[model samples]
Target: MEDAYTHKDLAALCSVSETTIKSYRRKFPGFIPVLTRGKPIRFRKEAGEVCLKIRDCFEKGMSVNETLAELGKHFTPRTGAAPSPSPSPARSQQVVSPEYLDKFFETAGKMMQGMAALATAQAKAGQRLEKVEAVLDKLLEIEARNGERFNELLTKVGSPSPDIPPTASSSGDGAPSRETVRARKIVNVRGSEGEVRSYALEKEADKATGGLEQPPGSLLSTPIVIRNDQDEFLGVPGRLPLSGFVEILVREAEEDGASLSRWERAGEAWVFVMDLTGGGSHALYFTATTTPRGNQVALLERLDVDGKETTPQFLQEFFRQVKDKV
Candidate 1:
């Protein structure tokens, strides 16, 4: 039987807080497999192997986004849930028991193993399969410290198999690809009443205090570009698209005398608490989501800061200074 572990085991192995693991689970949905769900979540032993890699990436100074991208190479989600092997006539009549569940899981593991083998065969012969083998080996570990937890969590949630979609980097040797980090376009924005303001992103040199540059597109800030209703070039939403913007926002908040109480990757967004200037604290959200227009948009919001809602003017000023010195 493949080994199973709890959140505590993964945290201790990765030298990260349990909260951090939960954040990883939320942010990178398809990356790790949850053997059991609900409170006090349990993970497959393979999770620990992946966590170890994540820890190494962080220790090497790679950001959360970068770490996930790196992990994409070795970990590939199965197309569908693992299929159960054919049962014998007598076995079919027998009542399902713990041993039967273990056998079923074993079959699923073999399915994964077959897929991995096929991947190896597709790769160039004599290629260094160190990383791939290591991940598979760790996944096949027989430690079952939390079998009961798995039984319960899986009982509540139908199947144990994950249904995450595969990424471009999940196949082959996992070479770095521009497709993995493509810049998402944010063409235009529509207000509450469908009032639209169209805009385009243009690259420009980062200037000190220069207002607008020619071509009406160059923002002269970070690689990201966005404009307001008045066609005034605003700074990048956060700094870069996705989590990169979150990192910049965190740095800016800290530099602006906001003490960071906590930060975590929340679902498709990054949520963090900032004790702002003048002895007040607020929750800051850096969210990236796909717009209805098929473009990705990065949004920054301050929630209930000092008992005051974030105003439109405040957002405008915030965007203008998002990349003040950068």
Candidate 2:
């Protein structure tokens, strides 16, 4: 059985605005409050609700850090798997009851509505900002005209008048606008001893040395974006396949301090290796993140060795030998 509370009561307990509560619910589908005809609404009294909120935040593109901050908690040390005693009896009394849960869902519904409302509000604000900016420009132009006329009138009347003040110090009209600048990291993985990233984009027709042509069936190079925990794009790279034995030039070294791990299958077991090039010359760490992807992909991961597994250090050396010839 559930004890129910009204929308207002739940809002007070959650320490969030009714509007905010509604927004939170909108992110997660199918959130409902238990309600009764004559009594208040009821809500679940478990941390499960909070957990779901965290998941929803992640799906909505919020980072783990953002999720923690939203729930008003700090990082706690993890404990080994073991049962712990329940909270003190007095503390349990303060926990949210089912009645409060009902209210929480109600607020959650409103929050979803509010999020929709907020999107609408943001669009409206953008329009309003543009309008205000336009109006301000017009007003400033009018002021300019009025000042000219006033000064002329004063001179004709043989009266002394003060000069009009220039535009406000706070005015942004003449100031340069700013935007976030993102640095582009490009890795030039040109095979053999050659120019940076192959000046083969066709535009450098005049300056590029074409004495060296790529051997047939060589790497058809392309780039992939490296993304951060925040989903912000960090670098563009062309990862050389170990099969091709091509050397990789890691550009923008500072941005690439973190190593990248790769997984592949060899025979029955799956193998993994990480690019530890930045760590040292011919250095790599190997581990398994999962089992092999069957014989089909395993053929691709096989090496000239026992056709078993491979480490990143071997890969770097294999490609280095290729570069040494040219």
Candidate 3:
């Protein structure tokens, strides 16, 4: 006769904590046969195999929902064997043969190797596709704005004030604009090879000042502000006194349940890889400094997933918040 196992047994078989097993059970209700849900929850003998499958999917980096879906594809209910005399305790202890164990390990190894190769190929293809799309979109935008941009340049050139010489540092209105003079070039680096991400900055009318546009956080005083893909705020980014604002971001992410997978200093800037608890990961590059010029934290790219996601759309709101705080 087969022996049913308790939650503790299943946890041990799956090599996961009891709490993790409970979470999986909640996610995949009815997948496991629960004999009882009292003080010590028990499961049918067949639930052991299901637990193993769950563990495999998680180890392969599949999300909880994805794991459940994948397992559901090949799930089969257990059927009891024909009635027979119970085996001796010593005989029952010998479950798997050496040949079977060796075969299982060999197959698992091949599957993992194939999966790694496939994942690498897919990631590279996706990154290349994203870069191409970004470049095409930028070209189309520049083509569309050629007329208006040319007119603006002509206006700036034609209407220069005779009293105030039109130097490179001075704005067209004869005022020295901080944006034009203090703006720094930020390069977006991405992909496994980590090539420099480059694209044209299209002309946009500033809604706040009703004039020329500025960088994402140019008008704000805070070190950084974060927002989701839908332009919703995800709380303000961390700030430090002198330097190491990047360290503050890492600490804040840990506090918020995000795992810091990769972090490294790149020249004068920094790159961070964060794995969100909700699933998916993001690569962020930024530069923060309190220099003789001023305090500035510049985000190089709009936080994007698959090339298009949450952009830094809260610049106006950030400026408003800083003004209110002051």
Top TM-score model = 1
TM-score of each: 0.26, 0.15, 0.23
Cα lDDT computed for each candidate against the true fold: 0.55, 0.39, 0.54
Ranking by lDDT: 1, 3, 2
Off by over 4 Å in 1: 1-239, 264-270, 276-278, 301-304
lDDT of 2 by residue, 36-137 (tens): 535444444332355356556767997543555555442221233122223466765557787898999999999999999999999999999999988966
- 1-326 in candidate 3: lDDT tens per residue? 14677777888888888888887677666677777677677787778888888889989998665676676666753344222223455654467777898999999999999999999999999999999988966864464356445444434433323344333366778877543432222223466886766422233332222344322222122245343467443333343221233444456567778643454455655544567677776555555433233424343333434234444554344323433432
Clashes of each: 0, 15, 1
TM-score of 2: 0.15
Segments of candidate 2 deviating more than 4 angstroms: 37-42, 46-326
lDDT of 3 at 48: 85
Worst 10 residues of 2 by lDDT: 200-209
